[model samples]
Target: MTSAPVTQPLPPQVFPPTLREVMLRPRWIALLAFSLVVAGVLAWLGQWQLGRAVDTSPPEPGLTEVVQPLDQVVQPGDYLPEPLVGQRVEVSGTWVASDFIVVSSRFNDDVEGYWVTGQLRVAGAAAPTSIAVAAGWTSSLDAANAAADELERQVSADPTAVVQVTGRLISDEGPSVPPSGADPLTITRMSPPMLLGRWHDTAELNVYRQYIASQTAIGPLDDISSPAPDERSRVNWLNIFYAAEWAIFAGFALYLWYRLARDAWEKEVEDLEDEQAEALAESSTSSSATGAAESRG
Candidate 1:
């Protein structure tokens, strides 16, 4: 006679759920969504900071050629700020013929040349202020001398006549020593201080620290070209560092979620394993007791 096969009792179910099941739960899903939102906001903020770090303002249009009235921009006897060094300005003044001088070592488009410089006495001045002006450039001393002569002739015709001059404002080049035994009129640099002593009628004359390179020339002289302003962008390393940190934080947020899920899954697996082991031990003890009772009978 065949007896029915005995059935072992099943192990008890674990209380906590696996990682996959926990992730599927509504609470975990909401938490995951919230974490993503927070991470995304942080990442965006980091990117904004990075943009600010690398961003720079564009150079002002026509920085060298934008013509502004001289009186509006600055006053005589004041220092020209670095920002306004190459700006074009217009003023009304009369030429000082005797103050006209010649400067060597001047260059125009890679060609070594000379500059014909002179002072422009401001019109209607009670205190007698003046600004040095480089009237024109030439390759030959004769041409410079001729230009200077022509300018002097015009001033000589009417010294009190107000002449409107347009030119670029520049800082003083500072004084330079003329070569020993050189002509008293021969100058090495375009310095107002050097020219101040040579200028005529200086009992009450106030000289500007800056000078002007005139666009208008006297009789067939080439205009002195103004150089373009320098515009360079500088990078901010701190902002770049912050961007990287934000990206790491975003990844960490996701990792934290994964780690929690994995821990929950491991705990559930351990509980299941322990339940199975206990069930097996109980079944073995029951079998042993039944065999011993049969033996006694």
Candidate 2:
């Protein structure tokens, strides 16, 4: 007969650990904490970029279009501040014919032109004062001169006439040297000091540091277009893209932690399943041998 079927001991069944259990391990816990720090930093960086994008868009207060009196905005002899630049101010004064001059290299509606500039003796000031004015623009030098000559004649005809001038306030263009042999009436810039040297009654006069680009013209001369203040800021689309990229990075850092943990858990599960399968096969073979021995007995 056949020897009784020898029984073999089966190994203990093993099962894969769950993610919750693995996360409790010191190594995984440390990794998760590190990921948290990295994600936090990335989030902060994205927020900083977002703040930069927001700051680029500035608010508009409509100061450029608001019409105000020049004396109310800035007093003569006082420095024109940044906020007052491009402001529309009205001044009523008589034009000084002797100070009328032409500025070359002026542009009107994107076309090169000349500007006829004059000084206006401010009305009812504490002292005798003047403010430079860009009276009109012309493409031809003769036309510019003709406008100046006509303005001088009109002002001289009625020296007491209070000409109301409305224009945008601008800062001094700073000092510049005219070309040699240039026309004595031609200037390269709107610098007040340069104009002051040629103005009359300086000993008793105070000149405003800034100048006005006039909207009104004499004798059909073209109006000098005063561009409005633009406060709208441009959006940096590239920065916005960077912000989105950073956000994705932050999310990926966390996802990487989960992926690594899940991979380890799945590998352990597969090994446990294989071990259990082998044990089942061994147990089945031993059972069949025992049955055959019993039948033979």
Candidate 3:
């Protein structure tokens, strides 16, 4: 008998690539490079924030305690520097008695009170210059008003008298809005701009952007409770937290690329399985029909 010809074996189909393999494709690699660029920019911004959050050259301890001239420390209309906010400064000026006003909501050692504020026309300036002064603090509103009235009378009696004041120079407590139905004359903050509005002879007046919290009260009120500023820490926890957030964002960028590639690979695998199933079903139907036709013949 003739030998049966050897049946040729069909070649095996190539296995589909894994998710990692899909990620290595040129298109996905380009996307990875773009993500790297974005991450780099975010990291740079985080580093910038870190640099600004801490003070590298803090002033010496008790530097603000040493007395200095008001003009030497800061000029009229100039903003006070942080290191000089509570600086002990000496200034010569004449008090505008009528300009003494009462400011409510003053706090002294956690106690809510009031402040009797005044305008001191700085002495020896070529033009008219003034600085706001929180003369004293009191618990009762009537007491605050009485002190202001007395100070006004004293300044009026000696309008030309030059007085020398030594106190801690401070930045202005910018103006605030009064309560909805509060009195028009009621003020609650030691704001130089607000005091200037109520000051007389303000034509061409040059005013200090900062103010003074006098160590000695002008009348019967108690001294203000302004303590020394605490030394700042070198390490900024907030900046560190922000840096961590940026690092997380960077990691997310890479993870996004991996996820997209994995999704695409999974879809390809599903389609391949569907195509193979359809081919098998068609082949089965063909075989059944051929056998049926032969049997009928």
lDDT of each: 0.79, 0.83, 0.85
* Tens-digit per-residue lDDT, 1-297, candidate 3: 434333333334456778888888999999999988988888887788778667788888898888899999998899988778899989989998789899999889999999999899999998999998889999999999999998888888889988888889988888889988999778988889988999988999999998899888777789988887676676778988898788788778888877888889999888877776777677667767766666666
Error of 2 at 107 (Å): 0.3
RMSD of model 3 against the true structure: 4.0
Candidate order by TM-score, decreasing, is 3, 2, 1
Candidate 2 deviant stretches above 4 angstroms? 1-60, 232-297
- Which window of 10 residues has the lowest lDDT sum in candidate 1? 1-10
Give the residue spans of candidate 1 off by over 4 A. 1-59, 124-126, 232-297
Candidate number achieving the greatest lDDT relative to the actual structure: 3
User: What's the lDDT for candidate 2?
Assistant: 0.83
Tens digits of lDDT, candidate 2, 1-25: 5665656567677767887898788
Top model number, TM-score: 3
Q: In candidate 2, residue 268 scores what lDDT?
A: 79
Ranking the candidates on lDDT from highest down gives 3, 2, 1
lDDT, residue 71, candidate 2:
87
Write one digit per residue (lDDT tens) for candidate 1, span 32-55: 898898789888988887887774
